[model samples]
Target chain A: MKKALRTIIFVTTDADAVAAFNAYFNPNEVQISHFTSGMGAIQYVKQIGEADLLILEEHIKPLGAVQTIHYLKDNMNYSGGILFFSDSDKNEIYTDNEAFEVLKKGFEKSDLDRVLGLLSNKKKPVELNSKPYSLSYLINLSEGDDIFIKESIKIFNESVGKRILEIEELFEKEHYKEVSNLAHNIKPSFEMLENNLGSKICDELAHSQVDSSKLEQIKLLRDEYMNVQECLKQDFPELFKRV
Target chain B: MQRILIIEDNPMVVRSLEFKLKKDGYDIVVAEEGRQAMKLLHEEIFDLILTDLMLPFVTGTQIIEHIKKNYPKIPVIVLSTSTQEDIITDAFKMGVDDFITKPFSPSELSLRVKRTLSKL
Candidate 1:
């Protein structure tokens, strides 16, 4: 009998990602567990550190990605393949680990099929879908130079509301530890666009200490981030190129 | 030939960088941690430093700050996948010469290294 290759997947939305994975990933080689909650995922990885593959997501805590992955690995004494999947796949796509990101975004269904087929048959990388240099979006970015700025703005307009809603929910649930993490996660895109106002708001909300103060900071910051996004959409149509 | 130091844990990235720099006729040295990197600075002088931000025991920023405080002439460039603003700003505050996001082209990296070396 073939040995089972255990996989611990910290997932949030199934929409199509789970289905895609299920369609692929050999049953004999892959035994996978999905976690809807971030804390629960961490607990499982801690209690059972036998996973051979780890799929992480940024939905649980906004910017808790690098920190969470490191912490989980440290606590569990787990060292294996790691993949990060984020629903917020607007413009940012990891290049070095681009193949994994491709899988996470449900982009390369055929490659995933090949991976499953190889794993099921106990094949090596020789027969699998091998990429020449991890598939990166920088290649895409060069082509999308004209559209990149506009597309970025559109993504900002669409995601800002959802980001604020998520943060508010986290606050309501008293996930105080995650406030800064979430802000940090969102701050990058804002900073990349030189959105100083939005960046400042995220910075303040991330570091606030008191209860009411934190809430107030979040509320004020959320508005600022949102307003900057909207104003960019309206005020600077020439520079931002709103879609 | 200019003295160059690489502080990165990932062997693949290091090897890739080494190939590009060597082809350009620059002398290079590499280290994986902050403390070991600091030790190398004591023995040989480097014109430029290319470092990754996230590292075990010793961080890229710590190394950059050490170089700035003691050597002052060597310029440090931070290479990271991390997009955190504070980390980027902190590196500059500690006197980092340039910051580049990860998955950069080896040619582009080589060009930046040349530019930094020329500046010194």
Candidate 2:
């Protein structure tokens, strides 16, 4: 027997949105509940247990998307994925995390289908040869400008390399606290690129715990940085001069 | 055209916001850190302020405090990734007009800016 679609809690004040959702997803296929207010939705979830997915409308009056997500995450400790939908041009604020996605009012059923498919799959699809260069950061930052992409890559190539050297010098001087803070700051950039090795090294260096072998963590971070640099040089040969 | 100041450290965010706001015909000035923002606030008059909560040299709260004390006439909006309730509550108490979180859509930001300006 095939498994049933996950339960989805669709929270919204808009009548049209509710109608759209009802028309799209069959009730029998997936468990669905509709709440008109953020507080109401929260209460429903609290009464039962967690919903597999939360489809939140950005403009839910007194509770809104930000406050609702805040309460759910901070107070309730709800860990399910969230899909934010907005009918207007109001900016929806959210972090770039594994369980978060956004959809606009005009999105069709296919868009919702694609997002739902991704959310249902436990394992994320891997990109081919992601190790050579983590391009997602630039892809987002540049937004498809060829010149802008090239310039950003060049700047990252120069600035990140310099910062790595600075971190090494700081480590050599035994300024561990400074190293920790610096690593903490740089870790987000690596994480955005999906470079797990670089992010892991940074996390190890940033930890407040002190050990005799902590310098080894810095050395590992340095090696990871070199690998990234080499990868960039090899992939974008025109951007870097032969050393 | 309305003149606005953007105080943010992230270069990507700055570029995106500046592009959209400028296209909407707002005159803009940018500062990459809290101290630079302070300097700009003193040197020029602005209709509104958009700032990130986490900044170097000075924190966003400190900047908001300074604005409330001296530039109380200007409306302020916060754009940050901080999820702390105390931080946000404190900003509202200090008289910030609005709050937005990071990774927000540009269209949404533009609309908020327009609405806030219209209210002012």
Candidate 3:
């Protein structure tokens, strides 16, 4: 059997879209981290590291997909793949040759499938221990009203619940390697739920908080996450339907 | 508080305007792309529009056209990095109230915001 390749992926879209995307990419080794919005994606990637691929929508309302792409590519130093989607364009906005080229060329949509194929072609199966992390989902989910975004929290809280426990066990083992890898992997999970404790845990793993100070920070973060888990379990048991 | 809509792409420029305008107590809404800027107008009414010439998704000119056709009550000012005569004339023809270029002092943005808000 071929050894699996370890890679990081970041995505932003609706919860349903995210769930669908996971079936396709099957990211990381042990767990999968997912995100919801463009800002949340940018923050997660900037704080952690580069993602192997970025699956985005071409027509996210309120914040145009192209403009957010500008912010991500320009400010974040993202070298990941860019995948975009748009609803059947009612206006036929890109019918003009000039418009088509700008959309196709500037956004680098041309290189998409090839990137995906190459990623999939990596042949090695995913690491059983790899986790998917993405936070952009929260930002994307938080449109229209607070209810929509809150729904994202409820959904992601469930998705990441068990994995949080598994990682906590790994962390207690002083398995710094696993902790660092898992931290980098699940950074998106903490972000989508706005689980500040999860963020602090991932932050230390993602960044340079090595000594005693970082350890204490992680412990504090773990406590906070325990509270967040309780809150999520008690509130909104049904969770919002995916869009 | 008067409502102002700013459609600009560059963050540095956006932050600069945001800083000065907030100090003046204006309720500001921002859009980095023309398409997004237009969507905002559909829901909220702004007193004045301070737009840039170039934007992603939809151009600044498109914004002017949409606003002209729909929200004629709102005055518009074009504060962009472009000073091309055709751009100016076109914007003016589209009913943009004023056109100013960037590298301008903070006072200039304050003045233009004041002028446009005052005229409205």
lDDT of 1: 0.59
Clashing pairs in 1: none
Give residue A133's error in model 1 in angstroms: 7.1
* lDDT computed for candidate 3: 0.57
Query: For candidate 1, lDDT tens digit of each residue in A1-243?
Result: 122353435354453565556545645456445544444455545433434455666555543556556566567655555556665555344533433442345558675664455344532221221211111121122212324434455555556557678878888888865665566545544544445566666766655553545777777767776666565655447755535
Residue pairs with backbone atoms closer than 3 Å in model 2 (clashes): none
Report the number of the highest-lDDT candidate: 2
lDDT at A144, model 3: 21
Off by over 4 Å in 1: A1-243
Which tens-of-lDDT digit does each residue in B8-100 have in candidate 3? Answer: 865434555665688679998999788889889998988988888666578789889999999999999886533256788889988899976
Question: Candidate 3: TM of chain A?
Answer: 0.38
Q: How accurate is candidate 2 locally (lDDT)?
A: 0.69
| Candidate 1 C-alpha lDDT tens digits along B1-102 | 788899976543454466557857989899977788989999988888888876657767777778888988878888765445688998888878997665
Worst 10 contiguous positions by lDDT, candidate 3 chain B: B102-111
lDDT scores for all predictions? 0.59, 0.69, 0.57
**TM-score of the B chain in each candidate versus the native B chain:** 0.92, 0.93, 0.93
Each candidate: how many clashes? 0, 0, 26
Which segments of candidate 3 are over 4 A away from where they belong?
Answer: A1-243
DockQ of each: 0.01, 0.09, 0.01
